[model samples]
Target: MKVYKGIGVSPGIAIGKVYVYSHKYVNARPEKISSVKAELKKFEAALKTSKRQIKKLSAKISRHLKKEDSKIIAIQMHFLEDEVFVEKVTRAINGGKSAVESVREVLQEYEEMLLKSEDEYFKDRSLDIKDVGYRIISNILGIKNELEFIDKDVILVANDLTPSDTALLDKSKVLGIVTDSGGLTSHTAILARALGIPAIIGLKDFSLNVREGDEVIIDSENATVILNPDDTTKAYYLGKKQEYEDRKKEILALKDIKAITRDGVSVTIDANIGAPEEVTKAIEYGAEGIGLFRTEFLYINRFELPSEEEQFEAYSYVVKAMKGKPVVIRTFDIGGDKDFPYLGLKKESNPYLGMRGLRFSLANIPMFITQLKAILRASAYGPVSILFPMVSDVKEVIKSKDILQQVKDELIQERRDFDKDVKIGIMIEVPSTALTVENFIGIADFFSIGTNDLTQYTLAVDRSNENVADYYIPLHPSVIKLIGMVQEVAKKNGKKLSLCGELAAFKEGIPVLLKQGIRVYSMSPASIPEVKKYIREITLEGKNIPDGFHQGEVDGGL
Candidate 1:
């Protein structure tokens, strides 16, 4: 009769027996020594085998679920092949430990760090390493570790589920998901949404408290999980479940409807995506175009920069799929918070302000132009435009366009077909850049206000620093004034302005933003329907915006 409240990352309901899944402690530090080369070879073979298995699982899951939910397997496979991880395992083996013993030792270091990390995102990442470690060690020992579904429907309770674990799960038998740790951006939440299952995350200790086969009701809509509920509560949830299903049907009906405001103002809503596969999900959710195709994923999950042809294939896939629905692709916004160790990027004391985004690209011009060439080549296929991130001045914009033009000249000599009219744009993220938007607006064809970084830099608060998290307010008066200024100038100069940050998804500040004349909104796929519906119901009605918008409580979206 106990009720536990958690963050509802996915919406729906499921009634099932509890199936608690946990990994057994592996203390297999062998007392005797084994041949280093033989053991190393054995570990290598197992690692190779695990890579194949993960690839197969990814392929199978992509066929059933949306491709975005299944892309994590590729990331794990990258870890399996990472030179650092490989060298560490080799070093451990050379230090006179058996294959299983050495592998466990090296992975345990990472597992412990993640479990001990103060940052919530880093702490949740332990689940991924542990899941992969289990696979590799089990492969070496010839052991099989997987979720065993009981004879009836069940809800999975775990500290957290990795993309590998969640991807291979028996979707038909497992009715819902409950996890001890994760956030809205976690893969567990994204996978659950893509799978259309009810899920609750950041449950704290329900995995430890809940028992096997105990009847439970997972109410994701209300973010509640009830254990051994009384008859009355069980009946109430069952009726509530029916109502949710009915509402889902109604929401789906509005998918093809236009996302126009109540005053008959037509607004364009697009989806921010990671991989090209996610473009399908965006279009399926009624995204008119790809607003922000983040190119960091191409660099993150690989050993080296993707070649021009490889990058071209990926970009062309989305460009063609949208069927002339203008795709705005942002170049590799890596380095700052998004680390690519294989690239040999120097360690910085203050990475957020150091080498990152457009700054990183400027330093590595050869690699930068390679990616630009690919995007330009893909532009020939369909509607495509390039957007730059972390831009601080008009000079960087001119320099980047100069390099792009240089590449275009080279492509012309080689007789390559590309859109000579590909548009160039910059993200207004830095406080200085936002304050002086008029200086850069003339050269840029369009602008997207990256509210995430704008809020961080404007308030001089590190969003990742938990101690100062309260100061990172998106609705602060200065932040609003900056955005208002950008909106006013972009309008007066006849330049198109859009909000592509996480703030675009939430409706809490919709009234304030609409009055600012932000007609273009881009967000995640799951947000499209809700945002579209909210936009249609509300109109500015010439409401006056408060001067000090930061007076009340504000929860930042992105």
Candidate 2:
């Protein structure tokens, strides 16, 4: 028996035969063409065909999956629509290169640069380019490309499944996924989680070791894969699979129940989402409200800025859907790992410490005002609060509030219908902000602790870097103390405080945070069920609230 290990992105188990799926590798040989005009025309036609196929597939997938999942295909369409990509390919073709060769050469260069980066975000983006490049070349060559056919229950193994390739998968037939190249943030991993499929990615060359119809046992709970398991091992895994399924069912049973402690402490469970479509899943999972609606999705993966009308429509859709539940829309945290080319941002040696979050929005006054106006307009529909990310100074909070008031005055002059008393909040992600929370109690309405960035900045470790990933500990004594300090200050001031980050969903960290006086926890929608179950199991009998603060009084504001 052979055993392989990889990162388990989606949690589950599957004991089945192997289904070795493969994509037709397109090799564009360096062919020299005589007619530049003819080659350019052929390239343009191929691009159009590829785009149409993507749109059709996107429409088809939206009918079955969440609209956010269908967005994977829409992002691919952006690749075809990007002017920089088209111009580079066109320039290469005009220099006497064949359409197919120009596409392969240009995309290969782009992919290579991204692959060389340490960031997994860049690596995932390269896969999209690779997927789009493959389709364009195949269309140019007249090679009929179709999704892999799965006939029965099997562990689907591949080199790497692209976002589009994973979207076309038959979720019912594929018991599990094992990919040779992928991380937790990869598009395939994201789709697998959305589909509730068991996935183990980054198993380099595991496909080469297995043959079609070979018995495979995927233990995603432990990130283990066993090939040709013996009877004893099979029996052990069969029992394990049953336990995992039972645990899932038990956790899901808490969907309708409130996330309250056994000792009579109440904590609000909310979901963080990138787009309005994800609000449906959040509600299905029993999210009390939308904690962090990342507004950057509207700006990223596109060639131009999203107009005010576009932003207003999206914010309104989410706000109305929540039906009066408090929705905290974080104004575009764009920079650091999430960068847009249209912003014309300079390349910084250290992007995390560079102009990001509130700094970026403040510097670009026009863009910030447009987003502020859209958010304020949407507040008329339901309870909406504007959240500023990566805030460190007291002055930043005052400056932002000033701009918000200015926008409100402008809307009033235009006779626009909007909520005049919209709540203003700031994220306490920086160490400096957490340490000085007392100063902001009178300035901001509420505070949310972004533990992801707090841990990174405090520990001086890049969470994305694999070399020092072990040092990125969120539960370190110093970090936990910072969280406790912020909770204490917020509670003393009677300002509602929520914790939104990966740390919020952590089962081991939740009890500690509750003991530290945090009352609101926000996490990914998928994690809501499990986290609620864990919270229901927790009891803080001996834990006393600091300063005799009433627990019921904290759940009042945004």
Q: Give the top-scoring candidate (TM-score).
A: 2
Cα lDDT tens digits, model 2, 162-224, are 877787778888899999998766888778877878889989999998899999998776689
Total backbone collisions, model 1: 0
lDDT of each: 0.79, 0.83
- Judged by whole-model lDDT over C-alpha atoms, candidate 1 comes out at 0.79
Q: Name the TM-score of candidate 2.
A: 0.88
Can you give the lDDT of residue 500 in candidate 2? 86
Give lDDT: candidate 2, residue 382: 95
State each model's C-alpha RMSD to the native.
Answer: 4.9, 5.1
For residues 1-558, could you state the per-residue lDDT of candidate 1 as single tens digits? Answer: 999988777778899889897765455444355588888888899999999888887887677555444656766776798898889999988988888787777888878965664334445566668777888987887766557444557898988887766776777888999999887657788678777778998889999998888988998756899999999999998898887677566666676678777778787888888788878778877888888899877664355778988889989999999999999999998766566656777867778898888988999999899899999999999989899999997888899989998999999998999999998888999989998999986799999988888888999998766569689887788888888999999999998888877577654566678877888977877667666766777657844322211111012233
> What's the TM-score of every candidate structure?
0.84, 0.88
Clashing residue pairs, backbone N/CA/C < 3 A, model 2: none
